[model samples]
Target: MKTSIYATLAAVAFALPAMAQDMGDAANGEKEFRKCKACHMIQSPDGTDVVKGGKVGPNLYGIVGRKAGSQEGFKYSDALVKLGEAGEVWTTEDLAGYITDPNKYVEEKVGDPSLKTKMTFKMAKNQADVVAFLAQHSPDAGAASAGDAAEKPATN
Candidate 1:
């Protein structure tokens, strides 16, 4: 009985970090999102502007749970399109990593060092916060949050 209890405890401990992926503070994320505004905008399909921003990047209204590089009207890099073709979907955890290092993430995902992203800026900190903010605008927010929790590796 004691051994079984210890095994259960250990399992729970290992699962905690995966469960915490969607627990980022959305309020703080909104503040951290200012850094992303210069390139991206959060606009709804019905023309509602959640956060008015630039057109340099695609509209981020439904980014969470979206397939990478699948946003209409945005010309994506070949690398991004290839990643999407390889079944890459945008989850909060993946988005956080993408923001931290788009180039490296693309390279890793596509296994091509020559592939590069159009995005030059990188968000090294407050990634979870920003992803949470983006998630709030996502139409499939619940799905993105829940799916990501199951799919992402444990984070420190």
Candidate 2:
């Protein structure tokens, strides 16, 4: 009985912290994501850029479910294209990893050797904030019920 009680308490304790994380507000994320405006444009009908509005990188409007490097008109490195062809789809976790270290994630995930993705951009060190912003702001983040309502449960 003691062991069971302790286990129940442990489980509740673990769940409490997870329940406490704020999923963030998109409106707030839009403001916070302003810092990223230099590099990324998350648009719905069309994307805009302050820095020449040119297509240096792919449009990220629907990036949440999009395959890596699969934007229609943009040119992607062979590595990213290969990742797309391999049936890899972008999820929030993948986006978070990319936000943390684009080059590293591409290097580790892309199987193509000849083509290297060169996104060396680093998000602010506080990736949780970035992730929250991404999740909240992206139009294609998909199936939103509530903040992080669809989020996968935290794993040990």
Candidate 3:
């Protein structure tokens, strides 16, 4: 009985990391998202762009759970549209992988196998933190307030 109990405990221990990975902290993620601000801008409280830097990458307000390439008026590659059509919603892990290597992620999902993104910046360090930040703060993060939703269109 002791041996069986030990095995059960070991199994549970092994599964804990996987469970933890699913629950990323949105607040931490918001801080880490500073890296992405160079290319993308999140919405402000008054229903305007926060960064207002440039329109290099499309606004990434509601990217999580949103249909890929569905941001209105943004010119998305056919590959991205294909990714959206495949029902491949952006989860924490998906964002991590896409940031690490866009081409590999895009190709695996769509098969075009390109090595470039509309945004030329590469996120090498603290990618998990960035995803966490974006997942929590961005409109896509399912964290919209009444004021935010009142201004922005339905994204997710």
- Per-model C-alpha lDDT, please? 0.82, 0.59, 0.63
Residue 60 error, candidate 3, Å: 1.3
Across 1-156, the per-residue lDDT of candidate 3 in tens digits comes to 999999999999998766444444555556666767776787654767644545566676656556677777778776777777877777656777888777678888877765345655566766666665555545545532223432332211
Instruction: Give the TM-score (vs. native) of candidate 3.
Output: 0.64
Q: Best-fitting candidate, measured by TM-score? A: 1
Which 10 consecutive residues of model 2 have the lowest summed lDDT?
A: 147-156
Q: Write the per-residue lDDT of candidate 2 for residues 20-83, one digit (tens) a residue.
A: 3544334444555555666566655543532232245665665665677777777777777777
Q: At residue 128, what lDDT does model 1 achieve?
A: 87
Instruction: Give the Cα error of residue 54 in candidate 3, in Å.
Output: 2.4
Cα-based lDDT at residue 57, candidate 2: 68
By TM-score, rank the candidates, best first.
1, 3, 2
Off by over 4 Å in 1: 1-22, 147-156
> Residue 118 CA error for candidate 1 (Å)?
0.2
Error of 3 at 32 (Å): 4.0
At residue 46, give the lDDT of candidate 1: 95
